[model samples]
Target: MKDAIFEVNNVSFSYEEANEKAMDQVSLSVPEGAFYAVLGQNGSGKSTLAKLLNGLYLPTSGQVLVCGMDTADEKNTWDIRQNAGMVFQNPDNQIVATIVEDDVAFGLENIGVAPTQMPGRIEQALLDVGMLEFRERAPHTLSGGQKQRIAIAGILAMEPRAIIFDEATAMLDPQGRKEVFAAVQKLNREKGITVLWITHFMEEAAQCQHVYIMEDGRIVMEGAPEEVFSLPEKMQALRLDAPAAARLAHRLREAGMPLKAGLLHMEETAKEVARACKLNSKA
Candidate 1:
């Protein structure tokens, strides 16, 4: 029922040099403040879609609209980029300043924010990402996750309504991934920022409100996380895996256990298994 923050209407895009389209007839709408996950194998157009949403790549055909502004229109390009900021895989690529606070100020500086107002925005953005304590530290001295958070802070300072995370956790270690994921999740939950999370990690996608699976530059499946992930065959066909908890739960169901659907988390799945055991013992 919420207003759409992003709308893709029957869009198709081909690369200048490639024989095949990078995106093909894709249509999707992301409501304001929604968390949407996009899953895909390599070269599946997920990244291309991110670029399109942020105005880095205009759709070759059809349309991509961010905050109701068409991306193909050159006039809307600047506002669209600010309206839908992007966080990419590499933190170092986005970190332009020496100190943590300074990096957070980079975007604000580009937009010509008043000198006096910069401090408050920088402080708030760092605080949102839980990196305020490290404000004075050198960016290169920080851990990967911390650097990624700083990268996020840079975007957050600009106060964009939406953010496109294009495999933002791909280069991180498990803990680093968790750190970055938690930060983004907090922003989505507390601040109501719309999120477009592009990832190959099934567990990460399992936690989102909506899921879309891409294969060969097209959306092959989309629904609530439970609905899309419940079909393991389609995931397997695309060379993707369901979350570990979901996979194990599916096996238990096949073995005649009356476990419920949408068991995406390990703790929840374990609890359900224990309850099922209790019922069996009673029987």
Candidate 2:
């Protein structure tokens, strides 16, 4: 598609001396400015796919394109990375500078961004991630969520077309995860930036516009969250779980209550339960 920010066509990849392909013939398209999620269990190849999109790993077979540039071509590597920035699980590994603002500027410095143009970019990036007030604070002094936002600010400084989170919230606590997730969603919604979120959390995946489920090195399912999570049996077969609301709805239905499928949010599920049971407001 012409609007695709990422085009993976029949791509497969294997690690050095690996016994088998980590990803096999995976094909997907991420439209420009779309929020997409890839869900999988460990060793299910989602992370490997993330690396391919960012040009960190080239496909062993077939092609991976980012904004019309082929990742296999050595010349496209630098531009590909700049356009498709990646945030890994560990924020500490991504932080290089002691101070928050300097860490965000580290990428701009490496790319030789004109010194005159850097202040505005740095300040805006920090503000975008809600970290401007912490510009002078030491990176180590910030909480996990703050550190992750700083990492995102670094990517935003590059003015990336897309940002891929490779289990970026895996190590965060509930509050930390909420903070980072909010920042990511804000960037996608407000800045028109594309997002490819790789995660195992079903609830997090539910927030995205599209979801791809991977199992045993291939895409086992792809659809909107409601479409995918409606099948509890298939999700479990892939070693995945439905979001809490969906699970509760499924159990209620099985117990002889009349409820609809694909109930993904709590408020909707609560309303449905009340209607099905003919409960009064007090109940």
TM-score of structure candidate 2: 0.96
Question: What's the TM-score of each model vs. the native?
Answer: 0.98, 0.96
The candidate that wins on TM-score is 1
Candidate 1 structure quality by residue, lDDT tens digits, 74-115: 999889888899999999999999988888888899998999
Q: In model 1, what is the error at residue 265, expressed in angstroms? A: 1.0
lDDT of 2 by residue, 161-243 (tens): 99999999999999999999999999999999999999999999999999999988899899999999988888888778898
Off by more than 4 A, model 2: 279-283
Q: After superposition, how far is residue 216 of candidate 1 from its true place, in Å?
A: 0.9
**lDDT of all predictions:** 0.92, 0.93
Screening candidate 1 with a backbone cut-off below 3 angstroms (N, C-alpha, C), the clashing residue pairs are: none
